[model samples]
Target: MTDNTQHTAQHWVATDYGDLDVLRLEETDVPAPAEGEVTIDVRAAGMNPADYKHIARSGDRDALPVAIGYEVAGVISALGPNTQIASGAGAVGDEVLAFRVAGGYASSITVPARDVFAKPAGLSFPEAANLLLAGTTASEMLHVTGVARGDTVLVHGASGAVGVSLLQQARLIGARVIGTAGEKSVDTVRRFDGIPVAYGEGLQDRVRDLAPEGIAAALDCVGTDEAVDVSLALVEDRDRIVTIAAFDRAEQEGIRVIGGAMPASATYRDGVRAHLIRLAGDGDLVVPMAGTYPLADALQALELLTSGHPGGKLALLP
Candidate 1:
């Protein structure tokens, strides 16, 4: 057996806050599991825009040498002392998916047991790793807006990951969704059971034509001024208009904001995590895979995600 106390693993670290150039690979000692924690042999790491945005937006005063990545899928290698349970929340050798880890862009990581869940057998490691964050964010937005059966809601940036999840979840909730996307993504939106409305000039008119009675709610994932304005014009209740991207305007315009940085996002995600997993496992919800890259090529993937909407989720094989 390997010496547990001396095992080493490689991880990606941001040497500084600027761009993808800041990322560097380095070998480090594997962390031991603490109480309520588990050591995972990471097989896949999901990449999202938030991974890079968090670094780019950090000020000079922020510390350097920060570890990057937040979501992963893997097998449990060890469990924390006193964490054994009759429920078997996370046992050694169990394949699992986890989120909000300190540094997921690694071959191995130690995370709180609460953050781990059994990865559904139906999903590959990449798909399971890509599921939670976007799914929960979409679910939380719908929850806060009180979307329900027979309601018609507008979704901005409907071709992106979170947007796709929102469209699927809204349909599962029995709500009608009118999603906005570029011409290239119109078909994608339609395939997911959303009414595809091309975004650009006259978007408001187009959406109005589709929903003559006005929308029941609006979700802005793009944060474009046009998106917020159109949503404001059509959705009568400011409380029903939520933006996952436009926090500044959401504050000024009295609309709700639900993003990772938002205080309430944690509670929402925790409550909905298991439900999202079940839905994905049952094929009631699907996360489209745009691309996959080896761990060493993560910077390229992040660059692509940062460039613009990539139409789906990206995964890093560790």
Candidate 2:
């Protein structure tokens, strides 16, 4: 499975969309790429809340039996005839990472060439796998909110995967970030260069004290009512408040929302993907791994991810 070869790949399949109980390890034929596609021998895959949320809601649907991972990092195994990307200088067998696709839980995946980018030479497969979707989401959130240098930004759930990514990107743009996390995660937020405020009662007060100049913008990775309420209280303009989670209420509250069922425009998606790959390549992004599970133990992995409060991304190894 580690070497690039055309062979049957075993994948974890969710026979019915429900809880982790529905996920099963099953053997399936390895997929081949159509024109403008490349096949990957998946070395590592990243897991997120969206994986289980989609499974729970997709009950009895035909896509029910679909493969359930969105991000993977691996070596190119094969390329379809029309994939000119592999023919250019420094192409094919290039280690790469990709996002916004299915079938990443398997030993191999067929992805459109345009959806993939050459993995940074410095990152391990697991590290590269961790960056794709979460990094892109963070990038898009910062872009949409127009967060800029010298601005003070408040972020909720600041120690989670997306939160950490957002903190790093916001700092890169020269913003001073004040983030919320459980008391135990304060050190983690501090390590990321964010001012850590314990999340709970008095969150708004803590943020106000941390940034006496006032919060110019807010990004919520945590969808709790507390998170939404605090952001509304601190930022002067609702347009500067963005929630990656609370899209349903964003419009009513006048906060900007990005990355949910609200489809990302192609231009924004491309820009975010490029920034993520570049950050990984430049060593400016760090994706901590909470744990790793064998492909056979995928259900256990999903259970841990859905359990909530895990500090970093859960990875699947084949």
Candidate 1 positional error at 58, Å: 2.6
Query: Which pairs of residues have clashing backbones in candidate 1?
Result: none
TM-score of each: 0.95, 0.93
- Candidate 2: Cα lDDT at 14: 80
Q: Whole-model Cα lDDT per candidate?
A: 0.86, 0.80
lDDT of 2 at 288: 87
Q: Candidate 1: where are CA atoms >4 Å away?
A: 1-6, 60-62, 84-87
The C-alpha RMSD of each candidate to the native structure, in angstroms, is: 2.0, 2.8
Q: What is the lDDT of candidate 2?
A: 0.80
Candidate 2 C-alpha lDDT tens digits along 1-318: 122345688887788877788887788777566667788888898788877777777555855687888888888888776474422422557788777668788888887777777787888888888886788788877888889999999988889898999889988999999989888888889988999988888888878888999999889997888888988888888888888778677867878877644556445766577667778778889888888889888888887887777778888999
Model 1 per-residue lDDT at 236:
93
